[model samples]
Target: MEKRMIHLDETDLAILELLQEDARITNVALANQLKMAPSAMLERVRKLEEKGVVKGYSAAIDPLAVNRELLVFIFIKTKDSFANDKSARALAAIPQVMEVHHIAGDDCYLVKARLSGPMELMEMKRSKFSKIPNIISMRTTIVLETVKESSHISIEK
Candidate 1:
């Protein structure tokens, strides 16, 4: 895939840093911090959104509280060639599957999934994964502990 570069200035970087720190920060508050007028701040943020710099805002939920204590990374080998993303799309369609990446190496895809427990994982393997076409094999690795997990990206000048 081809990459596109979007130009960003110091103000844009500042806005990104603040937004990354707290997405819930109000437009008025964000403007105040940077000493920018609320309307100006809004315009800049909107332009960033238009450029695809700011994807979207979302809340971070606790996995344990939602009965999704088990986190697993499943490496999948598919029968399809590199040009095909059908298997990857199918895996991503599963609600339990949080992320699916078309990968390099022996495996065709890397899937990050959240499940209740071992029994749930087994059930998913049998009921869910078995239905996806072209999936030849799957090797799952369960995460015991997560020391650091964040989606934040630092914006440097």
Candidate 2:
């Protein structure tokens, strides 16, 4: 399906930037920041959601605090170019798999996973990954240090 392009005004863009920074910001507070009435601000926000500009809100959790310190990027090679997507969907069902992308180049998929430590990684490979069909091979790259990570997108009018 093709996506319908939605136009956003300056106010809508402002709301998006502010909301991205702090999703918990109250509507009255948001209105004060943009110097608009609360009702007007709320209506604009509602429209933004209806138009699909504002997808949804979520909290950012600290991976370390949750004991998910080990970060690894797994480059997966699959057979048949994943025409059926059975293997792709099965890989996604695992709890540790954070992000999966159908990538170009030598590999078919690039998967981001979080684990407690090396032991869990080994267990995932043996028990979880070994069950998925059509997975030809996987090359794991452990992250030594993360300079920066963010989910915020620059909203433009």
Candidate 3:
């Protein structure tokens, strides 16, 4: 899909803020909160979706509940071209890989992964990451504690 810029008014920002806070909010409830008609609210949400603003709704799960207690950030340096590298795609393909970003400076990519424990991390490094070609070096940092981690963004009203 082609990405294009879309101008947002105060209402659009309000809608985004509410959705970010609680995506499961019904159209009627949302419209009530915004003091707008339900049909108008629905249309706004539809436009947001069409513009790729509201990508998709998802259930937020607790990592600890799922036995994924360890959060590790790995900085990967590659010998291959940084742009459109197959290694980055391979890293992203891993089930445990939560986020992958092409970064500047020494590292080509910064990868975030959640694991059950250190053993699982070691296993992943040995079995999965080691096999990806052009990986010159990988530096793993285990997060001892997360002060705040959220996908939520504050939209100005």
For model 1, state the Cα shift of residue 39 in Å.
0.7
In terms of lDDT, which candidate is stronger, 2 or 3? 3
Candidate 2 structure quality by residue, lDDT tens digits, 1-157 = 3888777778888999999999999999999999999999999999999888888999999999999999999999988554567777888999999988888899989999999999999999999999987899999999999999898996666
Identify the candidate with maximal TM-score. 1
Stretches of model 2 off by over 4 angstroms after superposition: none
After superposing candidate 3, which stretches have Cα over 4 Å from the reference?
1-3
What lDDT score is found at residue 3 in candidate 1?
A: 100
Residue 33 lDDT (model 3): 99
Q: Write the per-residue lDDT of candidate 1 for residues 1-157, one digit (tens) a residue.
A: 7799988999999999999989999999999999999999999999999999999999999999999999999999999988888898889898899999888899999999999999999999999999987989999999999999889996669
Residue-level lDDT for 21 in candidate 1: 89
Best by lDDT: 1
Residue 141, candidate 2: alpha-carbon lDDT = 100
**Candidate 2: worst-modelled 10 consecutive residues by lDDT:** 79-88
Pairs of residues clashing in candidate 1: none
lDDT of each: 0.93, 0.91, 0.93
TM-scores, in order shown? 0.96, 0.92, 0.95
- CA lDDT, candidate 2, residue 132: 87
